[model samples]
Target: MDNKPLSFKGLRLLVVDDDPDTRKLISILFELDGAEVLTATSASEALEIILCFQPDVLICDICLPDEDGYSLLRKVKRLDIEQGRITRAIALSAYVMDEDRQYAYLAGYQKYLHKPINLDELAKAVNDLAQLQQYA
Candidate 1:
């Protein structure tokens, strides 16, 4: 494991989760890593934020009160594609089944993470995805 701190300076991130504690924890983690973090409790709120926030990455839970993460990822993909933007997304969920992982990939997530999440791994994954985007 890399002990170097994740550098997310100037990057914008959106974290969507119905659980307030989850949201706060993730937000603090990213913020501490130097990313500007935004939180949304539902898919609808996330979609609305995406329009203006134009985040570099989205970390979202699969389950929500309004809509599922898969649906939200689809919409975000479509919107970003049409707008000519590259916004990578990660599926952060409690569903760790093989089928769930497959479905998440099919739904267009760049990464899949299961809760309770390992913050170090999450940082590494996000950093890796951001690096990929830079090359893309």
Candidate 2:
């Protein structure tokens, strides 16, 4: 699993998920990858963190206790526009339908990963997105 760190060296990341286990799992993944990671349990909490932290990337779950990830992303992007900030986003979800994927893209997620997270793929996604975002 390349578990010796460095997969995401120096990257600042925020993960939003209502599920405690999901948040902890994702947080640990990035943390082990050498990222400075933060977690939020809801969309509102995510926004709060974004304002103060201005993280390099956002890894979020589609189904949240407060709001859907789609709308949360819209809000995040809108704030980015207004504040001249950029936060690359990845959508994590249990929805495995093609339509769900389409919605994620339309909602502005740079990438999407279904449940049963793959560490390699997720790290690769962060790597690719970081390259595009110029953080890698």
Candidate 3:
């Protein structure tokens, strides 16, 4: 068994959040799990990074400094299609309502996770989404 103890092996992850601590924590954890992570403090930065980084997956906070995660995901999804690329996205928020979850799904996020986040759940979500990309 090539057990390197990784849940994000070989994944390129883009983490977008306004909170410095949240961004840093996610980045450190994912990096430890063998993922290449890039973080953006705002939706604009995320958009710019998406064009260049072309991450395999995105983990975005629902509340952003500029635009919300829902809007950001829509823009990112459109841009990806234009570039003939496929990217997966996950939404993280403190909002734990059924409607919020529905909105996130409709906004192009594959998974919606609540905050304060569970690191293990986040890792599993990333792994699951990355696996789905292989089929896409």
Quick one: best TM-score, which candidate?
A: 1
Model 3 pairs in collision: none
Of the candidates numbered 2 and 3, which has the greater TM-score value?
3
As a whole number from 0 to 100, the lDDT of residue 31 in candidate 3 is: 90
Which TM-score value belongs to model 2? 0.91
By TM-score, the better pick of 1 and 2 is 1
lDDT, candidate 2, 12-130, per-residue tens: 99999988887888788888768999999999999999988988889999999999999999999999999887889999999999999999999999999998889777888888788
lDDT of 3: 0.91
Global Cα lDDT for candidate 1: 0.91
lDDT of 1 by residue, 1-136 (tens): 7577679988889999999999999889888868999999999999999999999889999999998999999999899889998888899989889999999999999899999989887888889888887876
Q: Show the lowest summed lDDT stretch of 10 residues, model 3.
A: 1-10
Model 2: lDDT of residue 58: 94
For each candidate, what is the lDDT? 0.91, 0.89, 0.91
- What is the clash count of model 3? 0
What is the descending TM-score order?
A: 1, 3, 2
| Model 2 ranges off by over 4 Å | 1-6
